[model samples]
Target chain A: MNNKNSGGSEAEDLAKAEMVRLLSIVGRDRSADAFEAIFRFYAPRIRSFMAAKTKDRQAAEELMQETMTAVWNKAGQFDPARGNVSAWIYTIARNVRIDAYRRKRPEFDMNDPAFVADDVAPADQEFQQIQEAQLLRGAMATLPEEQLDVLRRAFFDEASHSTIARDLGVPLGTVKSRIRLAFEKLRSSLEGRL
Target chain B: MNVKHHLSDEFLIEYAAGSLSEGWSLAVASHLALCPECRQRLHAMEGAAGALLDKADESANEDEAWARFKARAADIKVEEVKLEAPKATKQTVVLPEPLRSYVGGDLADLKWRALGRGAYQILIETKDKNTQVRLLRIPAGKPVPEHTHEGRELTLVLAGSFHDGEELFARGDIEEADGDLLHTPKATEGEDCICLAVTEAPLKFSSWIVRLVQPILKI
Candidate 1:
């Protein structure tokens, strides 16, 4: 167990380092080699993500391509100090999917009054986000399997509380409480640190 | 601003997941502009989503997808435009970031149409057919007719305060009401209450006279 834990942390460090290198090369020089490496690493994963949402192989592939194209175009905006590379990429994927849906219904203009540019925390807050993220990951690992299962369904599938409760064969309140408990734990774990 | 109420976790999750309706997302985004705590929470949720993406199973068409993507990337011209910082607009009523770009001017610039009984409203046009958003300015000590929502209604107090027979909502407080809630909200005596209200469907006013004019009001 100790060896496994250390190995997991070592993998995380390596992944973080790779992401930093990729962002620097893409942002500074627009290097094709770094772009190729990022494409190979993220394309399959992003395709899987789109597949889960669209459930159509052709549509998923189209969205995956669009998302990667966005990454290449917006590489200069990627600030590792603001958020982790994976989170930044995930946001791009999510927005691309949403934009695809919005395109189908042409009436919905993306430049509507209610829309606002996303806020990027100051550089000073970067350490707090990174530290909080690590703490959250550790907190997530300690959650009970059942709680984690519900959270995973909620986050990945975008399942509503009622839907998760129905799927798990539990009362609605139980599902809500489980989610609340999980968040409470995460918040408490990183309370003083933040 | 010391914001007391905030966007709920459910709403934040929906926003982060991109599952929220355009109208509702706008309300949340407006609130997010005013509340740093909620923004931090949203960032954490995004981090959680990213962690899940890291662990998700990979697809089979990785090689083919990469090849096609590479071919497409070669033809695209990536712009190197730098994002400009938002300029501070000198206005009497300082609008928050989300609303600032929409109004383009201060409170005086809005072409407010008088809603009967001293309440003025400006209907903001949105592309979403399912949801309608409006800015309502209630004169001090005036009461909105008792009403029940047909669908969900989210009201954010942009300026001043109002009492909905139960709680006092000040600036930056968001009150979420659904079909089940029915109440008459009145502006407090000290100042006029200005609210940003988003509704999925038109409201059901309690008074017969108000209902008769509801079609004309288009609230």
Candidate 2:
């Protein structure tokens, strides 16, 4: 476990440096080489993420490709001061995934409720966001396994509270309370930083 | 404006995780546009999601995915720059950014149909037959009949204030009601209340007369 943790941290550091380089080149020169590098580094992670949600390999591949395309097109909008590149990319991936899901479901409408316009914050606020991200990472690591399990299922499985409760063999109220407690702890741990 | 009744943490987390249905996401996103506090919280949640993605297991199709990404990257067109409209200065034109895009104009442009008493409503069309979204304008001091939801109802206060038996919901506040709860909401005196409401099913109005007209009203 110790060796695995160290290896994961090392990989994360490398990914961060690559993300910084990719953002700079894309923002300034629109360099294809840098874009390709980013595509190589992040696409696999994104594919797995999408696969988990969509549960279709072909659909996941398509969505992953679209997400990278968005990164290229919207690179100018990426403000390093506002958030790290990974967070920005994650948002793009999430939007792409949501858009894909909307396309599949005829009942979903994208027009009546439009996406929120991105608001630009002051530089200091951006710093706060970065600090808050770091604080949340540390806080997440310390969460009890039970709380983390509920959170993981909620976020990754996209399961409703009732579904989670049934799957875990717990009462509906217990599922809700566990989720609430996990969030409260996250908020409290990162209270002053945000 | 300071928003007091923000979305619950559970709702926000679901939203950030992209697990919410389109109807609920719209309500939450609309509230987010008006409330900066929730927006900040959303960003924090997104950051947390990013960390989780970082630790997610690697996919087996890395090389193939990269190749596919490169082949399509060139065909992707940059989004056209949106032309900014001249800002409207009238206080009556106070729709938030998200709603403004949907309505394509300010509040004055809406064709409000009378819905008995002093209330007016405009039903917004959507692809979701399971959910209904509408704009409600209630006259100051008028009380809506007591009602319970058949499914789920999420209301975002856009103007003025409304108070149910539980609490006061002002501008930028979101009130989520389910089938288990019943309450009568009244617009506070001094100003008419305007809200964007999204409901999964028809509301069960407690008054017999209102219930009788529910089919015609289509609320």
Candidate 3:
């Protein structure tokens, strides 16, 4: 039951199917205010993101404008049912930054996987473990109690569905479904930051 | 392509960090919105980002960036934005091949940095969200540390072949590894090996030398 790829294939199917549902939401409207809403939410963050690389605030700000303008022109490309607003915007910013970096450092080859790997450092080395744990606690606050319980078991006990079911006196299917629902809600709430 | 399968922790970390492709990030975000456990991990990762964002030295836009945003919003017409799009008739999550079934679609948000020579690592979102995805590249002859899996690990060969322990996996071959497996994958001669791995825990080094160098290798 605990196998992530175990018997709950149906749940996975449902999740995949659900994305189409969300993307429709994003594609519905492309109004100026809608653009503004998205820009307001992401522009500052995108500016910050670019600033990290350029060290020039004005340049970062200009890049942010260009990035948003691209988003405005390509808003048609977004599918809300497929992803959240934040993910879409963040992806755009990332691409913009990469392109900008490459232009600035033409010697840096974009296609070299070895080059990329050598540049990558371990993920957690930058921040202490304690701070991460603290953020997890904040995110947990948004989850419903039932979903939270299922998540706790999955993460802490590392328990499988069968084991969790046997302990909780529920069907394996129910355990899987609950876990899926909880994870879905959590991911939606924590977009760009997490 | 088991679209039903949950996204691996490593992939999720990358997605959360905004290192995936736009198309893929959309798919993963949709997936995460529906999956709770993954969400919690993502939440933890965000907390890590918050820590970094809080760092006094970290670069950011000016404090008045919000003012500029307000001006932009003011110019936007409210009525036109309220119009909505028609929803698709059927509920479906169709992804590109190989990654369709995988929980997270494609990495969308990684801000890749260049290493010396032909190497690069896109700083994907951190595991805790505080750390970052450091995708590294090695030439054909490069031999990485011989290490063991911290948990269930999935390695997909994206380009050339590399030896994992004694076995060799080429493009499209999915290698599922557990804690017992010790791996020192050397890319085949001629071409570099590009593999996408989703890991829950850190790689465990089998040699003291690798362990000593781990700190320096931190991305």
Interface root-mean-square deviation for each candidate?
Answer: 5.1, 5.2, 14.4
Per-residue alpha-carbon lDDT of candidate 1 for residues B114-167, written as tens digits (9 for 90 to 100): 998999988876667888888899999989778998877888888888998778
- Model 2 chain A: weakest 10-residue lDDT segment is A103-112
Q: Give stretches of model 2 more than 4 Å off.
A: A1-18, A103-121, B59-61, B74-92
TM-score of each: 0.87, 0.86, 0.34
Query: Which of candidates 1 and 2 is the stronger one according to TM-score?
Result: 1
- Model 1 has a DockQ score of 0.35
Docking class of 3: incorrect
C-alpha RMSD for every candidate: 4.2, 4.7, 16.8
Complex DockQ, candidate 2: 0.36
lDDT score at residue B70, model 2, on the 0-100 scale: 68
Q: Give residue B55's lDDT in candidate 3 (0 to 100).
A: 24
The local lDDT score (0 to 100) that residue B100 gets in candidate 3 is 29
Model 2 iRMSD vs. native: 5.2
Give the worst 10-residue stretch by lDDT in candidate 2 chain B.
Answer: B81-90
- Candidate 1 lDDT, tens digit per residue, A77-173? 8876754777788889988887887721111122333223335556647776566556666666777888878777876566778888898899988
By lDDT rank, best first, the candidates go: 1, 2, 3
Tens digit of per-residue lDDT, candidate 3, span B1-219:
121235654445445444443333433443443344444466454443432222213344434655565567456443333333433323232222223223234434334455444555543342233222233455686775567866555655555667765677664445556678776777778877655555556666778876776566552
